[model samples]
Target: MTVTTDIAQRQERRERLVLDHFADETRQDFDAVLATFAHPRYELIPGGEVLDGRDPVHAYYLQTRRAFPDQRHEIIKLRHTEDAVIVEFWLLGTHRGPLNGLPPTGNAFRCRMIALFIFEGETLVCERVYFDSLTMIRQLLAGVSPEALPQVLSGLLEKVPAQTPAVA
Candidate 1:
């Protein structure tokens, strides 16, 4: 194949891998999701969570999905960089279980997220996510009124600086 054709084919394969990851996640097919990665890893930016290796990444998937069993992504835009695919997506899910020691309030949340599907050549190495933590937190917390949201967010933001959690 020509160099240009080879590059295009590589991009196609990379994009397919990412889309299959999304599909497996939406299906909650954890094992299938795990298969898509050459190096299983995730970084939840707002939550300061980093899970690397198959076991930890599996546990991280379990924990988060346990909290939001219906969690799924809607791809809004996807652009390829030299080493990563930048995805702007909507993450939607309902609070169906305890999250971070808080009981579920049955409320749902929809948040826009930007994530990098990082790769070493054609092999996916990481999925790093960025989003507003406070918005999701507020939706999960019962009795958080629209009027009270600012105060609620401010309180959480204040506490954020105190804890630097190390993810396995």
Candidate 2:
């Protein structure tokens, strides 16, 4: 095969791997998702969180899923690079469980995000995700009055579970 053909083949393999990973995640098949990676790793940009290795990555998955049981991604675009596949997607989910001590708002959120699937040859290495945390937070807190803002924030800071959500 010519050099160009070899490069094309590698790109196709990488794309397949990425699509498979996303499918597994959508299916909530964590084990299958883990198997797609050479090493399970994630970099959550907004939170400055780095979860590396199988255990940490697995925990991260569990935590996020608990917070948003119906979480799923809608792919907007995919661009292949020499060392990464950049994906633009919409992450949609309903808040259904506690997140960082804050009770579920029962609100749904749709946030646009970008993730770079870094690779080594055909082996998936890491997924670095970028999104605005505030966008999701704002959507989750849609109908709170300006006068109640302080109380709402204070309650969150105190880790108090509000009986009613400030959902839209």
Candidate 3:
């Protein structure tokens, strides 16, 4: 096979593996989800958190799955370069469990995310992700009574940082 074909195959496989991992997480298949990672060196960015090994990654998935039990991730775009694959997607779910310390609101939420995967051979070694935090927070607080919407809005407006960086 040509070098280009080989790279394409590897990139496709890596994307499949990562998407499968997300599907498994939605189904609460923690073991299947955790097995997709490489090893202790695997790193996931965007959240600014590093998972030392499979165990920590597994824990992270557990918490996330529990919080968004109905979550489904849709891959809207995928592009493969020399040594990495970039995926743009949307995470759709309902807030049925605690998320970022917020109680369940049962409100549906949709958040766009982009992940860049760095590959070593056929395995993914690192992933950098970007998503909208404000949307997540809004959905999490949607369960408040109608009378409390103004209060929530006021709080969020007041909490907005002075120097909010614009997302690219």
Candidate 4:
């Protein structure tokens, strides 16, 4: 096969791997989820804490699984380049466990997200993610504390630093 075809095939596999990780996370399949990442430096960008290694990634997944027991990601688009894949997606779920210290409200929520996956050969080395903060706040507020929505939204934005380091 030509180099171009090989690159395309690798890109497609990388994209599928990313989607599988999200799906496994949503399903509470922690082991399956953790296999997709590279060791010692598997990084998730755009707000979620950076995990240094496989163990940390596993720990983070445990926490998230506890928080979002019913979460599921729906992919809207997948675009590939030679070294990266861009994914546009939406997450839908019910808040049934603790999330960022917020108590569960059992409220259903939806949020849109976009992520760029950087691949090193067939493995994903990093993921840079973007999502709508406003939508997330709205969903988290559903049936709980509408009056405090403004404050919650403000806090969310404040947590995002003014300057985010670029993903390599």
Among all candidates shown, the one with the greatest TM-score = 2
- Model 3's TM-score against the true structure: 0.76
lDDT ranking from best to worst? 2, 1, 4, 3
Give per-model CA RMSD.
Answer: 4.0, 7.0, 4.8, 3.4
Cα lDDT of model 2 by residue, 1-168, tens digit: 999999989888988988989999989899999998988988877766677899999997898899999999999999999999999999999999877655677889999999999998888889999999899889877875688777667766675333332111
lDDT of 4 by residue, 1-168 (tens): 999898777876787898787777777887887677665344444454466667877777677667677778888999988778888988787877866556666778888888777778887777667777668756777766668666655654565544545443
Question: Candidate 1 clashing pairs?
Answer: none
Per-residue alpha-carbon lDDT of model 3 for 45-100, expressed as tens digits?
A: 33345566777777777777777877888889888887778889998888778654
Best-first order by TM-score: 2, 1, 4, 3
In model 4, residue pairs whose N, Cα or C atoms come closer than 3 Å (at least 3 residues apart or on different chains), thus clashing, are none
Q: Pick the candidate with the highest lDDT.
A: 2
Candidate 4 structure lDDT: 0.71
lDDT of 2: 0.86
**Consecutive 10-residue window with the lowest summed lDDT within model 3:** 159-168
Candidate scoring better on lDDT of 1 and 3: 1
How far off is model 1, as Cα RMSD? 4.0
Model 3 regions more than 4 Å off: 40-47, 143-168
